[model samples]
Target: MPTVHLLDYVAGNIRSLVNAINQVGYDVEWVKTPEDVKNAGKLILPGVGHFGHCLSQLDKGGFLEPIRQHIEAGKPFMGICVGLQALFQGSEEDNNVPGLGVIPMRIQKFNDTSKSVPHIGWNSAINTGSDDTKNESFYGLRPTSKYYYVHSYAAPYNPGVLESDGWSVATATYGEEEFIGAISRGNIFGAQFHPEKSGVAGLRAIHAFLNGDQFQSLSQDLVTGKENGLTRRVIACLDVRTNDSGDLVVTKGDQYDVREKSGADAGGSVRNLGKPVDMAKKYYEQGADEVTFLNITSFRNCPIADTPMLEILRRTSETVFVPLTIGGGIKDTVDTDGTRVPALDVATMYFKSGADKVSVGSDSVFAAEDYYRAGEKLSGQTAIETISKAYGKQAVVVSVDPKRVYVDKPEDTPHHTIKTQFPNSNGQSFCWYQCTVKGGRETRDIDVRQLVQAVEAMGAGEILLNCIDKDGSNAGFDLELIRDVKASIKIPVIASSGAGVPAHFAEVFNKTTTDAALGAGMFHRGEYTVSQVKDHLQTEGFLVRQFET
Candidate 1:
């Protein structure tokens, strides 16, 4: 097998990149020091998180010059995500920090006025200079393919600006902003989106770059459309726990209950759906935009490094290219060996194990309550703060589990309440979403609005908003809750729970401003595949990412 040099810089989930490379028949060689770059024939820099941190780290580690020398020596080099951003001179994200100055361009944050700031999800990377007659896709890129992108800053696309400088560019539009998604020049390649997580389409790009095949012509049938915008993301969630037999299994809960409702073994055995790793791959193949495994079963008595969930993440990422989020047990805890582990360390374990993002559930509620108790002051020591600081905030996701608390009007109990469309048994016309913890086993004093706001201030990148009233109900998403939550936070909100059918997904997308929608039972029970929901969304005049062949 051929070998390509990869830089182990910063903290992120780079396992999938390695997996992608291996799948494409290339083995990865670590480019550890400045001296290592001179011997490399093909080098790839994979990065995530902040631009300043990426460039500053490389410079601090004495790698900046060697990388420059590698490119000047005309060796093949590729940059991904922040690795790509580091080629520019500087960015609006950090004016004090200087990039490699390779491109003489600046990256700017996307406008949040019309859409989400991070510009998360699948978007097209169309090569503007493609041959229309031959249907050439620059470096395995296609008009129809949508690559996974999650970033706040990007290089704004200006027609012929980089081309005049002998650089080829592919652009994707987010709202009204057109930005560079991928760019290439002699001996150099950069992708703002994550190719490793883009499924088969991304694997082809990696193969092309490694094989030095830039201008791969495509069949006209592959060019399905010129739609070049961020599409809606449909995520598949697996609630995983141990059954009565002590075997790890994927399980679903009804309003947070995971026991059998009826039978001789009623309420005796935990519901077993399937295996975590196998189910994850199945969803990926079914066109699920992302797969999440919430490790609901406790492993506190076991060592963090030896947890079974880590192994699950490791195995699942090898085959599932899309983003994988791990929730539950993300708080600080004492290991079985009497070693105290911080939440950041727990998150690092998961990230290194191949989780793209770490979702905080119960801990977030406690943190938010503490925040309000301290008069909205930051402690800078909480799980969210520490983790977000180490890895970019984009890597930290707050999983909110809230139950609807009914009231007659907005003034009831001094909580932020909305006029409810569905009245309670007592004829209450208003409701405030009260946050819950321990898988909705306990209710907190804080409201959902307060919890999300506090976490966002604490530097959480996204929210996994789950409604206790909706989970496993197969009724539909709590639209009123989703809308209120979306209205409160600037970061992305994933509407989870209560998705029964494909039409339910469409209803959430149409009725609410949620950035993404998640399905668990529907996908788990073979009731609906992710492709069906995406197809429904597409038919309803919405853009969605189709599974690449």
Candidate 2:
């Protein structure tokens, strides 16, 4: 049996890919050195990260030449996501850097201004050419097979590269342009979308790639394959922090402030309500479509050092089958012993600990600032871009904590300000949301709209729109804030904070185009269950998953 060698670089989704390949009964070996690449029977280069960084790492590790030689030898090889981009001569992501030139094309960032940049969701790939039944990638894939994609740049399909006798390609149209979704020239295969995360349709492609069979048969009943027809998701959030007793517990704070009064007790207010794993399992059992654990103090401490957070994830993942998102304190860290860790490495650890997506809060503010100052995303490596690349953008979410700054006139500030339905203390008529970092402790000059645009361009798969003013107030979601931010960006937006009742859940979904609604205190305190929220939405004529009794 031929073994599949997965190129384990700093920017690849090694764990997810390993799980996917292993599910198909293939033994995967990690390849780092050129010798490993040369000796491997079949090679797979998988990555999600910046164009220059990925290419630079490959060059520095001496795997570049071996990769080119492997493709030249006509042995079976596959390039996934960034790996597919690396096969091209260059990318617009970093114009100065060049790829391996295996495909003789230049990668271009999606340039259509009308559509969202990082096309982050389930989209379909269709056959672009004459019916070629022999194409390996599309062998068992049905027409218009929906696959999960998280990319800002892609290889522009050019017939010149299809000169090889067996060369064929499939296209996925995004915005106004059509780009190559899958490519195969002789024994080499590449896909811009992630098959590992695409469910059954994607796994079929992986199985076919391994067996060297052009066609794989599926049962007639299973023909209607797995599609990410994800409806509006209901997510349960647990704001976790260390209580006065130094125990990790879920706590809810009012307007981003969790304080215990001097009159309450010694030390501080005991906001410790419940344990993390316990709450997570409870929410999962209650039919939460997803669960999020925010290490409320993670910004002050290195996540790598937070063994408790990792344990929470490991324990919860075993019991919960739904998607899991983790946020708080996900920045680059330097240890006291002089050891430095990249932000992407931190994300890898989170994923390995069973986090399906890692959310960045303060780091996103900084990345947006740098990107705006440089006028291009090539300014510096950011956690959002790097992590999104390694895990695919869908696995990365940006949590924005924006406090509404009411202003009398929008023109007074350079940032985009919205007229308020409710007036401020001075009876101010207009307001602009100021993006904050450090758990909303420090405010920045950046506007929430500007930050959203910048992070989306930088490759954030989704936005966790949080309002510091409405947080834990239970008044309701800041509809103006959610609507304004949703109008500015095309990526899926999850309206966070200020959801008090079942009606509030329907209000956000009914009024705005938010892809999901998240609740914390309401669900955590037993006031309402995830099922209750879904029941209300369902009664309101909204599509919701009916929990199995």
Candidate 3:
């Protein structure tokens, strides 16, 4: 098998990239030291986290010169996400740090006032640098295909800027902001998207680059979308826990209760839905944009290193090409042997095991409370901050468990209250989303708005806004709750729980500005597949990414 050298300079879900590489008939050789870089014929640099940190680490490890030499020598090179950002002159994210200056451009942050900060979802990477009338594909990037992107900073796509300099560019639009999605010139190539998590389309690009298929004449039938932006993401979530018989199973809860109330077992056993890894693969095959796993039981009795959840993530990521988010028990803890482990270490373990993002649940609630107590000041010691700083804000997701607290008026409590369309039994029309902890068993004094704002300030990239009032209800998403949460912060918000059918997803997308919608019970019950939901979205005239084989 052919070998591709990967610079293992930082911590990330590099395993997925390796899996993608192996799937395309190429073997990965780790460039651990500067000496290893010399032996690399086809080098791939994957960057995640802060701009300064990625460059500084590369500089500190003595890899900058070797990488520079590799590029100067005209060796085949590819960069993913921040790895793409590393080739530019510098970035607004870290002005003090200098980039490799291969592209002769500086990266800038997206206009967050117009859209979400990280731009987390799938977007087009069409080769817009073609000089002729023909639609040409570069590095297997098609105008009709979409790739997964998650970042706040990118090289802004200015017409003819890179092309005049003998460079190829593929651009993606985010709320009127056209940015460089993929760029290539000579033997140097870079992608601001995560090709490994981009399904078969991404695999094809990886294959093309590895096989030296730089410019492919795309079929004339293939055309770019007339209206292109980020696609509405549909995620399949699996709530995993050990059942009563000590078997790990994917279970869905009604308002956080996993036991059946009127079945033959009649609340005597845990509702075992399916195996975690199997269900995840099924959803992936059904064209789910992403798969998420929440270990409900927290793996309390086992050591962190030996937990089965890591195995689940490893197995799921091997086949599921989209992003994989792992939640539950991501907080600081003590090992069985009495060694203290921080939450960042816990999250790193999952990242190493192939999780693209780590979801912080109760830990985030605690961090938010501490923030309010400290007069809304940030403590750099929090798990979200540490992980975000190390792996970029896009890798850290704050899973919010919130329930509605009805009130007669806005003055009912000292929290952000919204007038609701659905009144309570007491005829209360105003309510506040009270943040919860311990899987919705404990309620905190803080509200959803406060928690989201605090965490976003602390560097959280996305919010998994799960409504305790809607979990397993199968009615629909709490639109009021989703709208209120969306109004509070600028990061991507994933609406989870209370999805009964495909229309539920459509309704959420149509009524609110949710970045993504997640289905747990509806998908697990075998009532509807992820493809069905996507089909429904397409039928409604919304832009939906088709699942590629």
Candidate 4:
């Protein structure tokens, strides 16, 4: 467990900083004074207020000297917002105030008015380095990822550092001048934008820094073993099913139980033969770093793991080598006249069948008793954990489908009793949705938040949050669900269900602290390729997965 030191200064958003770092699997300690930096494994300086005020606080707190010492010692350090600009010689926002001077540059105001100040919204970075060459910092990075830029001044481009775009300024005003939006000097990295707030790209960049050599080398050499320049990831999903002819087709399910419950038709269901592969290819072309194929019908139909379907995927993967995860019919135990087989064998089969990861849904939830029994029987935490330890957490995914159910209230009236639908502030007068299993057929009063925490405790590395309300609706993600789940859990969350467009991906990343986003309908219908989505996200300043071809 590596430790990350977050500088607590006047300009920093302490909560956002802590949330971002924790999302990437690291422990964070608040460093409000110079002494806090002395024994830090890695140091993060995040600022939100005025640059001059931030500098003054840093000096008063005596952090400037220790920070310099840490940087000179080749320790991994990062500067965000004003914290980033403060690392340069000085900023125009406050005249005569000196910066860390680690990079030979000064920040200046953008005198243009065509574009608004603070340069809000999303922007792309054009890699100034050779397109054919990539460094560890840029690994798994798409051409562009959405970065939230909020600044009036920018750092001028210098050849001594690698720039993401040709606009010399890290960020610039509409038509006036270019300024540094971000900067990197060996082990020291600075960003004009708040990566924590920047969404998935920001998270990916942070993760990369934590996992890359720069952070590793610094952490190793400095006894903290942390480096800079890591970013977060945004993912897209495509759900594949079989048509009458046994050819792979794409369709969306309705509310996760339309077929099982009220006999409602599967919303967005369509015959999309050979479309999933095409959409996946397009996502790769568009710069999607990774894509997932959720065989939505595998478990329902009890069909033998689709070998031909996987073969098509294997062939498609050759052209676009992004990480692929497949899920649906993974059984850990089979009862045939009291005979049982280990689920690890099924997982191994998936790995050999060309999946980078395997997801367990109904099997895990419906068989909780079995898993609990197995854990006791096998002397482990749970059956899932036992299998995960064998295959590695990265290779195991837990799919959680939760629905919102209103808590009974005396004032609440049935929808059929109302003449005109008047919406309440609480939205339908409902309380909270609990965790649902067995394809949304069984609603457990168990608290979803508690369940999320429990799963993490059970050794789940990641959670695929699929909203039963939004499933196959093409209505967009349930922001409330994503936001609540994100706030409550520290593990990376993959937001699934109700993704209608590429912008939806941007919105999810921008609005919540979710790590990766998953979609199926949009990709299945050829609505947007993963590469196209990545390109859009990259233009928005998101760091995405890059494809060589």
TM-score of every candidate: 0.98, 0.71, 0.98, 0.52
How do these models rank on TM-score, best leading?
1, 3, 2, 4
| Cα lDDT for residue 408, candidate 3 | 95
Pick by TM-score: 3 or 4, better one: 3
User: What RMSD does each model have against the real structure?
Assistant: 1.1, 6.2, 1.4, 15.7
Candidate with more favorable, higher TM-score: 1 or 3:
1
lDDT, model 4, position 463: 76
Ranked by lDDT from best down, the candidates are 3, 1, 2, 4
lDDT of 2 by residue, 1-549 (tens): 347999988644456566668767798888968999999888999877688888898999999999989989988998888888888889988998889987667988887466555665445555444333333334445443556667789876665456454566767766666778877767877888887755555676788888876543434333333222223568899988887677888988888777644565634675766889988878867767778999888734443656578888777765564567889878787754567888888777788877878999998999899988887655448998778766667788999999988877988999899998899879998999999998899999999999999988887888999999999988889999999998898787889999899999999999987778899988877899998998899789765543322
Off by over 4 Å in 1: 131-134
What lDDT does model 2 reach? 0.78
Candidate 4 residue runs with Cα over 4 Å from true position: 1-232, 257-270, 273-278, 299-313, 333-339, 367-383, 408-430
Worst 10 residues of 4 by lDDT: 216-225
What's the distance in Å from true for residue 378, model 3?
Answer: 1.7
How much lDDT does each candidate structure score? 0.91, 0.78, 0.91, 0.61
TM-score of 2: 0.71
Q: Which digits, one per residue and each the tens of the lDDT, describe model 4 over residues 1-549?
A: 577888876522244456567777888887866888988868888775466777877888899999999989988888887778877788887876788876556777654333323343334433333233332224222334445554556775555354432212233223434445555556776777666644466676677666653321111222221212223355667667776566676555567532222335233234453566776667656655456777766633333343455665555544444456677666655543344546666666555554655677766664454433455233343545655565445456678878765534524522111211323456655445467766677876454665665555555556789998788788888887877777776556788899888788888888886767877667666677666767777688865544433
| Position 98, candidate 4: lDDT | 85
